[model samples]
Target: MRQKAIPALETLMSAARTIGNPYLERAKKAGRKIVGVLYDEVPEEIISAAGAVPVLLRGTGSDGTELADPYFRELTCGYTRHTFNEILNGKWDFLDGAVIYNSCDHMRRIYDNWVRRPVSPVYSFIYAPKKGGELARRFYAEQIRDFLHRTEERFCVTLNEERLGAAIRLHNEKRRLQRELYAMQKGRRIALTGTELLLVMMAGKSLPVEDYNALLRKLIASLKSCAETFEPGVRLLYMGAHADEPLFFETLESEGGQIVVDSTGFGEQSCELDVREDADPFEALVSYYFEETPAVPRKFGTAPARAGHLLRLVKDYAVDGVIVTRLTMCDLWAFEQYMLRPVLEKQGIPSLELETDYILQNRGQLATRIQAFVESIRSSRGS
Candidate 1:
């Protein structure tokens, strides 16, 4: 009966695509300005306050990365290369403007290239402070103020605390609803397949939080009466980013593995985290920064801690095997993958490692590997 959930999961992905596409369409129809945020540094509040929608742009599928090879070296992360490819291909032509943050050297160079040859004419570079020292804090504050001034001058929208707070409240409400949905999954009140949850979480980057929350709430309510029995399957815990794609989970399920928990940003990143109204917004931002597991290339204090934390999660969740889906060109995850594999294996845990693009075009290969790995684990258990 696990196979029966595939259609329902596909329906979820279809709904997410519809929701994300309509926002782009509405912006085009109304001629309302829209800006692409390169990474997580573009504050959702800033975009909301500026009267422009913030679309989180990332690389997906092989098609999006065709041109990126010439722009970014093969050694660079595939995500960055694919992002440039998307721009070069005019896939992001609908954007009225874009904000690129200097989060890392590669991303900084991308920002430089973007400003020089923008797909959209109104691109701006925002330098994100790397150090959390007092100087860095002051620098970032001034940068935020300057960015707001430029945004107001260009977009003719003032950034006020009230508007910012409202945006925060909206995001907070969305988080609450997402938490409810996650609770349903945790409690087995509904059996949402892994890929379905990944699609839903990914939609958060493009869709309006309020609308997505409503859809998720409706979905939860619709599935509240689901009384499916959990089959005795190899419980798995996923620890990487590329597993955020539903097809990855579908492949694992097809191989007789069930993902019971995930350590992906999509699964746990923005959920249950709230920006307190009374606290300084910048401080709140800094606090949120501290709370997040560092993405690739910025792994100072986070990697070892995240490794330990994930190990604990694996034990607690009763996961039989760990699947690490390292994204192609993501050096940080590659390093973490190396560190994590031996540690999990040393503990007598079976693990599988797979590298993938954000989109799942090579499902046949992935399925074959997963099936082999699951069979190996099952046979070992029997022996």
Candidate 2:
């Protein structure tokens, strides 16, 4: 039964890699609209309540940004550039509408470009609060309310309390199942690699919430029943930057380092906690997004606390080393890495920094660096 489930999990990964997922295609056939989400922090529950499927518009590994050069500056992050290029090249023309959140300056610039050019028929820019407090929470709630109102008006649908409750329940199940799957990585011997886990998490958001939840339940059960342990080299926790592709993880592991956990949005930050089912759904969403989600921009000035969080994961996962990856020209991750270096060094944890774009143009250099890093850790262990 466990062997029978591998192909099913691979199907979801393929759907995620494909721009239009199976559920989204089926929904379009039935005349349901698709809402493209720019960032992870956006309340997808709101989009679902508006009778639309929320699909995260992430970077493509094989695409270039040459067409997007005229619109954005030379130093624009590659992920943003590639996504914009896809829009300009008519790759994402199927999206009926888009909901963009102010996750960072690059994302906001993408939103600005879309507003100036108008890719989707309808658009909504949501300003997520950067800090946690009463005022921030209330402000976030108002933003969500506005988003819900605009979506309903655009789609001509009424998202009543009952519909909203159902959406919450569906999304909450996705989160719960993801947490259970990730829990398999807790001890020294685990069932899945970090790359596999990252793809599963990414694909979970790509498909419909109910379908993702069902598929995840099956995968988790298969992993629990399987007895194989991936005994690679030293255990490492990948920190910093958002990676939509698994090439980086593959490269790191190729050099004898097994990534066990990650600090990126695709890992522990991918809504492990569930939204309250009893409370008002919108308010619960606001609390879960603003209060629970941890992004680099939100913890800008507090690096020790962030590094301390990574340290806790190190202890929890029994990590031998860490690799902090930053996308070229990403100021947020760059600055965060600068702050996290000394903290990790003080703790005596081995760490390495890697810089790359969305595409794998310099694989040889990255492999060389990773091999050396892993060898150094092994040498120190023998000492």
Best by lDDT: 2
User: Predicted candidate 1: what Cα RMSD to the true structure?
Assistant: 3.5
TM-score of structure candidate 1:
0.84
Query: TM-score for model 2?
Result: 0.93
RMSD to native for every prediction? 3.5, 2.3
Error of 1 at 147 (Å): 3.6
lDDT of 2 by residue, 25-129 (tens): 888888888888865678888888877888878666446787888988888888888888888877778888888888888878878888787335546889886
Q: What C-alpha lDDT values do all the predictions have?
A: 0.65, 0.78
Separately for all candidates shown, the number of backbone clashes (residues 3 or more apart, or on different chains) is: 1, 0
Which pairs of residues have clashing backbones in candidate 1? Answer: 195-246
Error of 1 at 326 (Å): 2.1
Which portions of model 2 miss their true places by more than 4 Å?
1-5, 299-304
